[model samples]
Target: MLSAQHINKSFSGVQVLHDVHFSLLAGEVHALLGENGAGKSTLLKTLFGMYRPDSGTLSVAGTPVVLGSPKDAQAQGIAMIHQELALIPELSVAQNVLLGNEGRELLNYGRMQARVRPFLEQVGLNVHPATPVKRLTIAQQQMVEIARAVARQARIIIMDEPTSSLTTHEIGQLYRVVRDLTARGVGIIYVSHHFDEIEELADRVTVLRDGRYIGTVRQRDVTQDQLVTMMVGRELVAQTAPPERTPGAVRLDVRGLSSNVFREVSLQVRAGEVVTLAGLIGAGRTEVLRAIYGADPSTGGEVRLEGVLMSRRTPADMMGRGVGFIAEDRRHQGIVPDARVSVNMMLTSWAKGKVGVGERDMLRAVEPQIQQLGIRPANPHQIIRRLSGGNQQKVILGRWLSAGCDLLLIDEPTRGIDVASKADIYALIDDLARSGVAVLMVSSELPEVLRLSDRILVMREGRLAGELARADASEERILALATGVHTHAKDPAVA
Candidate 1:
């Protein structure tokens, strides 16, 4: 239903998409795979009328067409579901679904709810249509967005990172929804950084690298390793080796931690050790880490670093205690978006009365890290907002390391980043552990927990369920602990 030929797009004298061609046959789910800044979003915008390409043509149903805006594309039976959902929080599900197409212009919610109920049921969303959207979870809100697109009767739907925030069960529901849509002859363009999702849902996969089309392959014809090579154009060096540890005295010690959201939790991370907290979403992993760092006020807890007791205080106080935190939501709590990379990188150093370091020293320190992390543009003066998600994360991690932090409290260190960038972050963390920086991290991806952790602490329902050594950990053991499943076989790989 949608196809593009030789599309070329540019912004501010830089080409982002060149000689790119894509197609979405009716009743097919096409997967678009790329690392950060590979031009996947650019192609979607060009097809959705948000950008007018400098060259090439887009067609609908074999007819060439030019779209001036999203409305123009919508009128031609195309809809896009963005990663950040656009539902109005104050409105009900029915109201958000029929926002512009309220039929009689009189804003009758009862009639709207009745009209929206079928679409909700069609997408397997069982919530009442009258329910306010803000009351739902992230996964529920995403399903509501999908229902909205289905209500538009669009022949082509573009889903960008739809499963990024979803849990395993919610992702399964989304997969079922996608299958239902494809069964109805709806063409879908699925853009994501997940390889497993593509393997499960994509009928065909197209790879992009550095704004150029690499190639397309059928799902059954390509291995996961091959797909990684195509997307990055290099053999991925395995960076998952566990870090060597020469752990000394305990650097971070927490005891009887209690929050309104989390129960009593006690843990210790020693110097030169990388310890990770692994659990499913909403398991209070982020809460415990935030409490230790003083970002969240804990109802009760005793924390110490290097044998000095810590007080219930602010983030700056924690920093003064030789602790640094890398928040999960980097866009808000981490960086100054309007500032330059050099400024953001040196923010912590300046805040700590280390202003004697000149601009040359700051840039010199960041220059090697920039090269190591593969941050694009490699320009210290570039605005933080101009970098991709993965590159921005590298800068944030660089900020804390440059501050000379002794202990790091990190949450979801690589969330929403691409695979190649994930490798860079993993290696950096592994290096930190080797350099005697105690690291306590929370990650939802099991592979990460297995790859980096000297010890994996499993949290379930806000309590410590179990702990596994690096030599004994596996995906099954972690899942069993996270879900409260009893198993005599905690480490089958130990033998």
Candidate 2:
């Protein structure tokens, strides 16, 4: 349906895409594989007219096309759904679906709802047409986006990380929708970090590395190992399970923790111990972390640190008490985007009364951590916004490190980071624990839960369903606990 040849794009003297080539067919799902900064997003934006390529030729149905804006791409029957969805939260589902396509003259609510009904049904989005988009779940909202794309009669749809936040069941629903669209001859450009998703959904796959086109292969012909090698340009090492450690003095103790979302929850982390909270997206793991960090105060609970009951438990209070937190929403909650890396890195120190300290001293101190954490370009003055997703997360870790936190509450430290960055973060977590810092983490990735955690606590609905030692944990056991179920079959760990 669409193709680009010899594409080259750059920003601020930095070349982001170099001699890149990509193509999509009328009814094919093409998977784009890459690390965070491997030019995947740039390529998608180039196709969608968000960025005019420095040098490239694009064709639609064998006719050359120059797209100056997204409207031009839309005119050619091309549409893109960004990873971070752009739905208007306050608008109703039907309204969002027919936003621009609403009739020219008359404000016809009934007609619009009727028009959107078939598209919604096609995508299996069974929510009320009049329900506000904000009221829908992420997966439901995603289906609504698909419904809107189908309403627009887009021949090719670009989906970026569509299943990142979705549950397994939600992913199945999306696969069904994709099947329906493909049946109607719609081409899809699928971008994701998930190997399994690509293996299942993509017919052909293209790999990009360091802004250059690596190669393209049919899914059946190329193994996952080959894909990884091409995207990263190396034989990537696998992360092994963390080493065992003896639990030291209790650091964070939550007894009878009760919040609006969860109730009667109790957990503990010891000095030099790493305890991971594992569950589904809405299983209340993040909420539990928030309550412990005092970002969201629990309704009824007592949190003790080192056998001392706390009076005040706000974020400021927690920071003052040698506790640091990395929130779930990193962009909005964790880091200051506009600030320089040196300034952002020292935020925790400033919070802990580093007002009179010299800027040179601060920069000098963080330079080693920056080197240690592998923040790219080795420049401590780069704007946080300019860094890739992985580097941004490293800055968040740097902030906590500067604060000298005795106890850290981290949520999804590797949510959107790439594979290599994930390894760095995992190593840092182990280093922190070995340095006698208590770590309480919440992660949705099951492999992460099983790999880095010395102990795993599985939450379901709003309570702790089960706990497993590192020696006893398995993916099936963790998932069973997360879903509030148990089977008698022997897993290797249990066996």
Candidate 3:
């Protein structure tokens, strides 16, 4: 249905794509595989008319086409769902689905609901059409986006990280939707970080690295290890976290925590201890973190730091009390995407009055840490957004290090990062622990939690279900607790 030949594109002085050739046929689900910053997004944007390639020839359905704008792409029956969702917060689900194509003389609430209810049901979404998009979960919002594409009768759809925030159950639903779309001969180009999902859904896979096509392979003919090798061009190493540090007295304590999203949660982390919260999506791990950090209001709870009671627990209050948080959605909540590295690194230090520190001074301060943490390029003034996803995460870690946080709460530290960078981050966290800092981590990767945490706490239905010490924590133990599987097993330390 779509083909491109000899595509060339560039950003500023950097050439991102060169002589790239690609094609997608009707009824085929093509998997676009690459490490972050391999120009996958750029290539998708080129196909969707968001960027005009410096040089390329494009065709759809055997006709030469010049996609000048998003409308042009849509006119040709192509649609894209971005990595970051693009739903309006104030709009209802039905309105957001029908946006730009609502053809009515007057707004008909009932009519709109009737028109969209079937489509919503087709995607297995139980959400009411009149509910505001802001109130929906990330997975629900993605479903709405897919429904909108179906409403538009798009023949070719491109989805970027659609399952990043989805639970395993939601992913099964989405896979069904993809199957339904393909059964009707709609072509799909899927971009994702989860290789297992790609293996389950794709027929053919194309690999890209460093802005060039490496090769394409049939899904059935290649192993996961082979694909990783193609994408990275090197052996991927999973480094063991450093030696565990002896934990000191309790540095952070939360008792009887009650929030709208979570309730009756109690936990604590001592100095130098790394406690990981493990659970599936919607298990309320992020809500508990926010409540403890004072970013979200809790109806009933008490936070104590080293026997000192805290009267107020706002973000400012937490920061003053030496608590730092690195949120999960780094793009939306963590960093200033457009700012220079030095600027982002200096943000938490703003209260200390360093307005964009000089390159020499910033480097002088962060240079050794950057090297130790393996931050690529080691430049403090480079625009942060231009860096790869892993490097951006490292930059965020550098921020906390530069600011000297006493207790750190990190959420999904390696969600989409590369393996090498993941090792670096693990080492950085261990180094922090050695310095007498407490680390509370939240992750969806069971093996990661098992490997790095001194103890693992599993959440089920928004409550702490079980806790396992490092020596006793295993994949089976964590998974059983997370999925509510009953087994004759116990973490002796917790018992």
Candidate 4:
């Protein structure tokens, strides 16, 4: 349906895209595969008219066209659903969906909901049309984005990391939506790090590395290893389970932790150990982390660090105690979009009264962590917001490292990250555990839980359902516990 040839884009004397080529066929889902900073986002923005390529030729249905702005692209039936959500928090779902489409007209709230409801249902989003966008979960907001695209009736749709935050069931729903759209002759550009997703949804896969087109192949014609090699230009080392180790003194202790979303829950993490919280979306796993980090209020609970009860537990108090939290909603809660990388990485340390350090000293200290984490652009002065999702996540990890956190609470650590970056993050987490940092993580990906966890704790609804040792855990067992099909006996360590 759409094609671009020899696309070259540059920003501020730095060339990002070099002779990139892409094409999409009517009724076909084309997958774009690339690591962070591989120019995938840049290419997508060019296609969507958010950026005009420095040199290229774009054609729609065999006719040459120049799209100057997003509105121009939308007029040409193109729509982009970004990984970072763009919905206004205070606006209702229907209002957000119909925002630009609704022309200068008279009042019609009832009509707006009626017009948007079908699109919502088509995308399997069940929330009321009048519900505020802020009330929806990340996954639901993603579906709303898809629904908005459908509402736009765009023949060419671009989805960036659409399933990053979705549950397994939600992913199935999205697959159905994609199939339906394709059945109607809509062309889609699917961007993801997941091989399984590409295998299921894509017809042709294109690989890009460092802003250059690597190659394109049929999905069924290429193995995952081959694709990895194409994207990173090397034999990607697989992440294996860490070597067995004995944990040391307990670093964190939560007893009778109660919140609006979760019941009394108790867990403990020892030094040099990784404990992962495994459960489906809305299983109260995130709530537990927030309560522990003091980001959200806990009605009844007590948190202790090294046998000392923490009477006043606020985010600042936790930071002072060498506790670090990596929030799941990175775009909203984790990053300072306007700040430079050095500033964002030093936020925790500064918050803990480390501001006495000179600016040059702080930048010097942050430089090593930046390199250690492989944060792209590798410049401490680069604006944190300009980096890709994976790189931004690395910066967050660097922040905790700079603060010298002994206890880390990480939620969905690799969400929206590419496979190569995921391996890097896994290695970093393993290194942290080996260095005697206690790590408690929440992950929706079962493979990640099995790969990293020394112990797995499952939550269902609002309570702890079961726990399993690393050797005893599997996707089936985790699902069983998460869905209440079966519950393992409580581990004495956690009890």
lDDT string for model 2 (1-495, tens) is: 799999999766778899999999878899998876788888998899988999989999999999889989988999888777879999999888887877741277777788889999899988888899999999999988898898889999999889877999999999988888888899999988888989889999999887899998998898888888888888888789766877799999999999999998999899999999998889899999998888886899899998889867888888888998998777789888888888888888887885336877887778998998888646787777766777888988988887799999999989877777788899999999999999999998989888889999989899998889888888988988887666676754223
Q: Candidate 2 has which clashing residue pairs, if any?
A: none
Please estimate how well model 4 matches the true structure, expressed as its whole-model Cα lDDT: 0.89
**Predicted candidate 3 versus true structure: per-residue lDDT over 150-259, tens digit per residue:** 87889999998788788878889899999988989999999877778888899888888877888888988998888888988987875665676799999998898988
Once fitted onto the true fold, the runs of candidate 1 whose alpha carbons sit more than 4 angstroms away are: 353-365, 488-495
- For candidate 2, report its TM-score: 0.94
Q: Name model 3 segments beyond 4 Å from true.
A: 239-243, 353-360, 363-382, 488-495
- RMSD (CA, Å), candidate 3 to true, equals 2.8
Q: Residue 22 deviation, candidate 3, in Å?
A: 2.6
Error of 4 at 248 (Å): 0.4
Kindly list the per-residue Cα lDDT of model 1 for residues 1-495, writing each as its tens digit.
888889998765668898998999999999998887788878888889998899999999999999889888988899999876889999888888887777873367777888899999999999998899999999989888888888899899999989877899999999999999999999999988888888899999999888899998998899999999998999898765664578888998899999988888999999989999998898899999989988888998798878888875678888998898999887788889988888888889888966446878778877876777687757787788666778889999888877788999888998878889898889889888888899999999888888889999989888888888888788888888899876677454221
lDDT of 4 by residue, 303-389 (tens): 999898987899888888889999998888999998888889988878777644678878778988888888887878777777788
Which structure is stronger by lDDT: 2 or 4? 4
Task: Tell me which residue pairs clash in candidate 4.
Answer: none
Model 3: colliding residue pairs: none
TM-score against truth, every candidate: 0.93, 0.94, 0.90, 0.94
What's the lDDT for residue 177 in model 1? 96
- Separately for all candidates shown, the number of backbone clashes (residues 3 or more apart, or on different chains) is 0, 0, 0, 0
